[model samples]
Target: MSSFCPNCPDQTIVDPPQTVYENYYHPQHVQVIHPVEIIRQHHCVPVYHHCVTYTVKDKMCTVSGLKKKSRKRK
Candidate 1:
């Protein structure tokens, strides 16, 4: 039902059998998220290890979900 690809802002939407009801996405824009370890480097020295979660959109170099932070009053 979308006119454009969810993963690609400039690309038009494509109706793939797997995504009939969902927003369309280009074949190149569809990808599987993979897990990996991230190492923080400080001038060639490893400072720390960073863990992260990847979504399908992220794996395809597209924007994923949106998160909002609540502020506390002093």
Candidate 2:
């Protein structure tokens, strides 16, 4: 007579998880100070300027659950 097992199954193969990368841009405000010459005053004066800058950001995530779960009753 042959025996059958519910908990134990045949050979199973599992794949490795995949890694995902996402890129985004971030904006930053910067202040610039410079000296300028005036025709009326005939002198140099300090000037303030506002500038916008962008930065690169990287985000990583893992993808899993390639195979479904098995529902077995004991």
Query: Which predicted model would earn the best TM-score?
Result: 2
Evaluated at residue 12, the lDDT of candidate 2 is: 81
lDDT of 1 by residue, 1-74 (tens): 76985575565776756634667766666678999999987686668989998866434454569566689999
Total backbone collisions, model 1? 0
Q: What C-alpha lDDT does candidate 1 achieve relative to the native structure?
A: 0.72
- TM-scores, all candidates, are 0.14, 0.23
Please name the candidate that would achieve the greatest lDDT relative to the true structure: 2
| TM-score of candidate 2 on Cα atoms, chains taken together | 0.23
Q: Rate the local accuracy (lDDT) of all candidates.
A: 0.72, 0.84
What's the CA error at residue 46 for candidate 2, in Å? Answer: 1.1
Off by over 4 Å in 2: 1-41, 61-74
Give the runs in model 1 whose Cα sits over 4 Å from its true position: 1-33, 44-74
